[model samples]
Target: MTNSTAKEEILGRIRNAQKIAFSGKDLASSAGVVTGTPGEHFAVPRDYERTSDMPREEVISLADERIADYKADVRRCSAEPAEINEAVKKAVADAGAKIVGIPSGLDKAWVSGLDEGKGEIRVDEGLGVRDLDALDAIVTSSAVTCAETGTIFLDGSPACGRRALTLVPDVHICVVPADSVVYGIPESISRLRDADPTVPITMISGPSATSDIELNRVEGVHGPRTLMVIIAG
Candidate 1:
């Protein structure tokens, strides 16, 4: 049979089944095909679990492991604000960051240890794309992270500035709370949906890397080249 004949036969079978299921009518006897109503709705079964069965601690550990496997730096620290500050400071210092950009509403304590005289800290207040591109690094807090995918979600919250800030910078230092690390994408989306549905969300899996036709791996082609995740309890 020709390709067009085979295609028509498959489509005819699908239309016949759908007509039988939805309208209880046999389209085989009809001269013309039956079409579905534009606004018709089908009840889809959502029986799958929203998250994995891993424990909370295991989820966090898995997130760290997966993120590290992507060549992103992971810093585990205590729940204390002071400890988070120290970790952030060290990350910036290790990067030799001279100009750090942050969202206006980011917690000051995260980078409180940085010396202004030695390094410049710019709070983002509608900074142009060019300004963000010149910065050495940008630090922000993540809304949620998926352990299975090693994905971080930023919902343009006070902690997460506009998407441009994270995308334009060479390096990004994301501070993810232990509690925000979930087992999978469904759990992450559920948590974010409860928070706010209108806010823009940006998901980051790892440093921006792409392989060309030659399979040459190149980093930082689209987004930040370095991703430093601080998993603070």
Candidate 2:
């Protein structure tokens, strides 16, 4: 149970696996690793479930309930782009945010309602921390969500902008596609491999909060204080 004991057991497993692997038998003798080839890969057998048996709608519902338990607002909308944009607009309006922030690649329709109204839009065109902090709220799209954990991921994709865009703002309005919602962490990880490793992956279970200081919970210390999720299906 100790860290040392656990490490030894893991190393033992690698050594056992390496003993049979032919990739680089000599290199595998040390720490259970074959030679580090540029494009070579070894598939490790896993017993974990890579897909869920629960219905997809049930998965989304679980994600909704869990995320809401974190004190974040959660809602569902039709999967149509127009409907998602409308839901995003409502969330921002409900917050009474005057200035809104969007990454450069965010869908224009997502913020069109703001323009029609009096809300001012700030695009993330290389905005720094200070600029991002100045914004009242931010709108973004999510990559994948884990229903069981009520966790969401944001890789630096076009819809999901750089990590800073979500971190600095006071409020975050994220749109989640229903199809991207998975039941558990295992399934979530399996769906996330086709991206560059350099891109930062942010996993958020709730708003940035901590009870570490005197056991009194404080929000927005590390990231956005308010999280509004719009699940579009």
Candidate 3:
């Protein structure tokens, strides 16, 4: 049979076997929602759930512990450099890399320092979509981080730029301040409740890694192969 005819025959059989399990009324009632229509009630039901139980004091403590632990762990692994400049320099050198700094009016001195006097760096102030192949590494500050999970939160604002830069490159170096770090996911979500809904945010923990059927873990499955974090003093 011709391609169109073959496709039609397959589609006909598939449609005969297909089933839609829910009616609009059934779905809406099951969800405890009442509205003009099922679609209209989507937001209503969600707003009725219990508020988050993340305590402010507990969140603060959790953040402190996690940040401390991450710092300590990095130190134990011989993974972090002594200073921010040193850490940046080492990470770049370790990867034989170039720099991609997010635009936050980074001091010329600070940006120049990352080059380690090599003088071959690009300042992405326009914050346009960057080419992945041309970039070796990207570095920027995170809005906040969750210490409980070791996850970095990147709100795509003027300081952090887009999520693509973080995902596309082989290596990403995130700089986070101690004060901005939070304790856990619960705290993080609560803190973001009033945030500008327009911007996209990303939460990252460690290098992108996944496991196989044999439980063999592999890194960089969907994101950067390496994740290097610098906690600015």
lDDT on C-alpha atoms for all candidate structures: 0.89, 0.87, 0.62
Encode model 1's per-residue lDDT on 70-95: one tens digit a residue: 99999899878899999998999988
Q: Which 10 consecutive positions of candidate 1 have the poorest summed lDDT?
A: 28-37
lDDT, candidate 3, 23-128, per-residue tens: 2235555777665653454543434423335674565455445544433213111222346556666667777785555445333443456654653566565444
Query: Model 2, which residues run further than 4 Å from truth?
Result: 1-43
- Clash pairs (backbone) in predicted model 3: 62-183, 63-182, 63-183
Worst 10 residues of 2 by lDDT: 20-29
lDDT of 2 by residue, 128-147 (tens): 87888889999998889999
- What are the clash counts of all predictions, listed in order? 0, 0, 3
Residue pairs clashing in model 1 are none
Q: How high is each candidate's TM-score? A: 0.83, 0.80, 0.61
Best by lDDT: 1
- Winner on TM-score between 1 and 3 is 1
